[model samples]
Target: MRSLPLTPSRPVTAASDGRPALPPQHLADLDLGQRQTLLAGLGQPAYRAKQISTHYFGRLTRDPQAMTDLPAAVRAGVAERLLPTLLTPVREDACDSGATRKALWRLHDGALVESVLMGYPDRVTVCVSSQAGCGMACPFCATGQAGLTRNLSTAEIIDQVVHLAGVAAAGGVTGSPPRLSHVVFMGMGEPLANYGRVIAAVRRLCAPPPEGLGLSQRHVTVSTVGLVPAMRRLAGEDLSVTLALSLHAPDDDLRDELVPVNQRWKVAEVLDAAWEYADRTGRRVSIEYAMIRDVNDQPWRADLLGRLLAGRMAHVNLIPLNPTPGSRWDASPKPIEREFVRRLRTAGVAVTVRDTRGREIDGACGQLVAAETAS
Candidate 1:
């Protein structure tokens, strides 16, 4: 196993053209126009772009041999240039009777990232990473501890969804629908930090087939650790994806410690941006709070959180903290969690505890990658 630098040696910057250089350009990385132009340069007609897109986005198969409609002579070269392998699976773990599975992947540069596919009775959702590790530095998060590696390219992010979608379609997940219908950017990194690529990936995910994946935009969710500017920018993108604000703490003092980004954006500013997103998109913002044992689960804090979100276009998702290895943090006790929920409900805030999945398998975002790299 190759080890990756947990923290970037230098400050991370987006490529001048907003694409990462390490992973070779992929068809998913390009828009339809660029795809057409590339094929033209290869002496293939422009329509080959759409033909290839149908195989990838519509059929969810990237094997050149499976694209039988294309001329055999051109298949391998086209696949090499446009659908270069990006995520090589390192390890996969499953729990909840195989309904929830997590996969660790190695990028071209040896940086490790993870994505999770969860199957429910009615729908399937895949949580994907936007960056290899995270820069947020949230004390209780495994990914945050790993620190920033680099932003995943647009295709790197999208491929996770496409791959997982194929798994779901093939009935890899037990007792769940055979199709993937939802996506969440709540995996290994602070999604908004890798702003451009994440947004581009969302666009590709939602665009109709032959151009992109054709998933409904409303079914996708993008999470942020309160990057105020990026949150606000996402609102104007004409997208309606759910905005999940990982507001682990309601008060500034605790939040500054729990979510280090709070020190820069502050709780008030972050909530304001979330509200702005809700207003513009007409989609209720999801306020995500991790219930840590005696950390941010007190009744007072719940009430405070309720006060902030009450009567607003928001819903609180209380996540039971999935303690990382050697981390002091632990999930709030059931009684404490119940009390917290009661307070929020009393304050007229709609709230639900997120179903804890894949816990036995180090299901938290960065744990599997961390373990793989360590081994």
Candidate 2:
């Protein structure tokens, strides 16, 4: 495993924005029954809670007026308590026949982050951000290059879903409400760094409607660049959400360069943690390998990756490096990508190339955040 050079000082501080770090809190942020009790305390009947919930979770409606069944007076308070606005859309860019949209959001603190809403024929998946930027400096990532601003609160993370779910429900191009069937923590930040909030948000996402958004836990996938201790911690949390390890390279040497955190937790250690989680949860771990041209996309590396993942209950998702503007890295050539997948399959390892999404809109994972920062 490669070692990350330790930096001596923190260049950024909470005071950079001149505001106290506001803890994240939102209506969906509450436990379902707690939300009901809060509404009940406001003089609404107990059943009205369900009605209001249907508007938000079931219908994906945030507009109070659209909740026609509720009394007018109750709408304002309900919106205030349960639907407090979390993210203001700073800019939205769409492509792929309007099926893919990348939204740059401004958080309450003026921190910028992004989420991608991609609509496919079978499923509509939202790739959401967990932190404003990333703390784990992987060097190649645009967000990592900028360094982390702060961890996103649970509500701020969930707001991305609520907003995108609303967008999908509106059906911009897909005649019917696009079913938001999948979610990926592959957006602007490293989720595990914002450990507490990310875990809470997962529960909120999976909880049945009115209590939470009612998305199935299995549909959610959280990715990390091998934070071993955190992975172990997540294993014990009883969450069955899919764990995705950004194992960019097979061994520590290349991994250290690709994912700097590998210096702290080597490849073997990270895989052990992932295997343990798989054994415990009966969920297959997703190993995300971004194939960078001539860098880590070698055929031998592909063979090694297949061998490492061979018998474990795991799947390899090969992503062609979505090269960001001015970034030195580039995607592996098509022939190389095909051969890489072929080698993994030869080793009897399950693998698939990730369908490149949102390319026209600076879709490389952290590009939108970098753009926001530049603007």
Candidate 3:
């Protein structure tokens, strides 16, 4: 087995990628005990940790003014130290009668990333980025094409969830539940590439009140472009969050181009790790395949995919390729897409075409950020 690379638990003062390091530590970066320790060092009572946590996590407000429970003298200090602004909303575009919203955020260092909020009658879901940009180099993906800036700190990742959750609770998503219930790490980066921070963020997001936003672990979905080592490690962590494998193509030959990581870990190896994850967690794996026109959407590939997943605890999420600007890729036609679904079903593999939400507003993963950067 290839040894996994070490990922830092806290942001460094500088990044090797020529991008600035992540912002200072935020409350979401620390566990309950760490929070207490931090407050004690600042000459504040340890119990103040819980009080501030209640205001931030439970109330979902980062404004020190909104945290009236804290003494005025301490509020400013605590807020400046632990609640420094991390994400500045640069732009937000809404569609689907306001059921779908995509937000472009400028990080403290001016590196931009995006998150999306989508609401249905039953639930509200937020898709968040794990990195400012992506290193995967999946030719058709906007973020991948732009390349990596830096890994987001654990707090940076969690802040996206908390902020969007607050928006949902305020009825920002039309005709839907007024609370955010689901989270997907599918916005800009290859999540597992920033393994340590992503795992920390997940734990913080799912922990109960005063510690986290109190979300169910099962409601969180983390997508990867087949980071085999990270997938195996995640299974051992005992987390039950859904694991989504971005297996854009069923065959290694085509996948090598669509998802360059395939060159390192072949299709069979990646799927084996995914199956192991499913077996250990008892959570069905999600196979994410992007249907690119005249690319990997051939009928034979669909049959091959079905054969590979037959009888496995997996579901195929067929994504119609959302074309990035100046990209040669395009979504498969309706007939081609329907036939792909049919083949998977005929082979007894569960499949569904992903809803193309926010298509008009540059909805696919990094589209919004890409446009912002270009401008």
lDDT (CA) per prediction? 0.89, 0.83, 0.89
Clashes of each: 0, 1, 0
Q: Of the candidates shown, which would achieve the greatest TM-score relative to the real structure? A: 3
Question: What is the per-residue lDDT of model 1 for residues 1-375, given as tens digits with 9 covering 90 to 100?
Answer: 122234322222345786645788999999999999998999999999999998899889967777888888898888788988787777777789889888888787678889999999999999999998999999899889989988999999999999999988888889999988999999988888889899999999999998998889999999999999999999999999999999999899999999998999999999999999999989999999999998898889988999999999999999998899889999999999999999999999999999999888889989998787788
lDDT by residue for model 2 over 137-222, one digit each (tens)?
A: 88778888888888888878887887788888778535334768788898888999889889998998888887678888899999
Ranking by TM-score: 3, 1, 2
Off by over 4 Å in 2: 1-18, 21-24, 40-43, 173-177
Model 3 stretches astray by more than 4 angstroms: 1-19
Note the residue pairs that clash in candidate 1: none
TM-score of each: 0.94, 0.90, 0.94
After aligning candidate 1 to the native by TM-score, how far in Å is the CA of 344 from where it should be? 0.5
Poorest lDDT segment (10 consecutive residues) of candidate 2: 1-10
